[model samples]
Target: MSANLQSAANPSLSLKKRILPVWNQLGMLIILVLLCVVLALFAPYFTETNNILNILKQSSITAILAAGMTMVILTGGIDLSVGATLALAGVISVMLSNAGVPAGIAMLTGAAVGYTAGAVNGYFTAVAKLPSFVVTLGSMTYLRGIAFVISGGLPVVLQDKLFIFFGSGSLFGIPTPIYIMAVVYIAMFFVLKYTLFGRHVYAIGGNEEAARLTGIKVERTLIHVYSISGLMAGIAGVVMAGRVISGQPNAGISFELDAIAAVILGGTSFVGGVGRIQGTIIGVLIMAVLGNGLTLLDVDYYWQLIVKGLVIVIAVLLDKLRN
Candidate 1:
């Protein structure tokens, strides 16, 4: 029948063939590979193995933060304070380590600090019904100030060699940070694709009222979501501290820009309720590749900042068009 044939030809007839988000990610994948190719051909030393390692190492911190950003953005909410949280956790962890705490416990303490900060954000955002932007924006400044006060405007040098290993060491010839990044992605991918909690996240983002009417416990879920974001920030701060072998209160300034940019580029909607970890990881790589490629071409850091800002604006424009 003609009707049947047309129906079969329509990709939307099957969930697997419907081509919005998935196909978009495919396009991103192609662009990422092409970027690597072009950079390799034109950029000096870019294709070298050691330089490749360096790129990954440099990208690790951004990737880690982007993972958390992905979750917050999925809910049509944002966390501006994550970068500040990084400083707070990093300084606290290092200060503890220097004062004779074990590396593992010190790291846990840092993560807990992040979690607590996230909880505060979530409590106000959900229970108090405040705008996430406002709450996190205020927290961002205060948290950074706290970091400065606690560290006395000095870097906290870490002597825990084991913690340092987490940042710079390798496992089976691969950077440890790479492994940490991979694990986060894998864990997030599994949660988003195969878990009820993940489905709830998507549902909440797509339509908060509808989800609430459907008995989703919107407030509780939001609290958990914000908490998760802080947890990821804390995790990132620990690795960053280890990488630098010191905790600098000034670390992570303007870092939120990169994380949010990566998420948006990866096909996540700012309007809430549509995105995937796969797209996010690809976006992360694209950002990293762009940064790396530009650096290889000897672009000035200020120019890079301009480029990054333009990328965010363009990505946002494209997102609006897509919607």
Candidate 2:
């Protein structure tokens, strides 16, 4: 029976070869489902419709932020200022609403503020040739400082109903934030899949010098990428203001960490240009489910932080192995 044993051992090895590709492609999705299943088993009401909706609603902000982060990461850059930009934008939007500006105009103005901030970041990185990390790190500090200065260190309460609807209201019984999340993902997916800009982003991430040599406007593209990231942060700020019904300077603290974690967990390369929008959303869902499940299990918030950090480390390790 030695011959039979040898054949059986070979089959197992063959099976591994067969399974690796699927695991690489659907690993995050599989992890998400397993997490859901385990939580359902151990956490009471974890599978309830209301709880599921709550998870989606809570994840919407992170999902929105991760969408922009995907582009930035694909280009082999990072934006540490998005969280600060969110806080500043939220504060501005709320202040404008309090000043009796139309909700639409105020929201747009807040987004514009984010765009300007991102453009400045891009300029420093592209034109000044400073590292993205350094530029955004500086931007993060100054932007938060400005938010506090303008608001005089006080929260601006949002009173506009229309503004609140974007955060709190539902359509066809689905949360409005969920709808916004869907739209952002859909648009991002289209842009990354079909547009020339998307190709350029990938090219840059793959090899910046080569892309430039091939006639890509590397400088212009970087500016646009960072600006998009800022705009998303700005939009997220408005949503947060609506949810909390106030603009707090302290809002979105450490949000950048979560976005980066989600992006990495979704299988995006930390180095850049090696991931998809689809994977990022799955990563976002995995994080949301993990957090929600932990809360339901009465896990301490501090422990949850530890767990999240560990998850990020593991994800990076897996990414390295895959690459």
Best by TM-score: 2
The local distance difference test score of each candidate is: 0.88, 0.92
Residue 241, candidate 1: how far off, in angstroms?
0.3
* Candidate 1 pairs with clashing backbones: none
lDDT string for model 2 (1-323, tens) is 87667658899866776787788789989999999899989997999999999999999999989999999999999999999999999999999999999999998988898889999998898878999999999999999999999999999999999999988888998989999999999999999999999999999999999999999999999999999999999999988888899999999899998999899888888888788999999999999999999999999999999999998888789878877
* Alpha-carbon runs more than 4 Å astray in model 1: 1-23
Task: Score residue 165 of candidate 1 by CA lDDT.
Answer: 91
Per-residue error (Å), model 1, residue 205: 0.5
TM-score each candidate.
Answer: 0.93, 0.94
lDDT of 1 by residue, 201-245 (tens): 899999999999999988888898888889888988998999999
Candidate 1 TM-score to native: 0.93
- Model 1 Cα RMSD, 1 decimal: 3.2
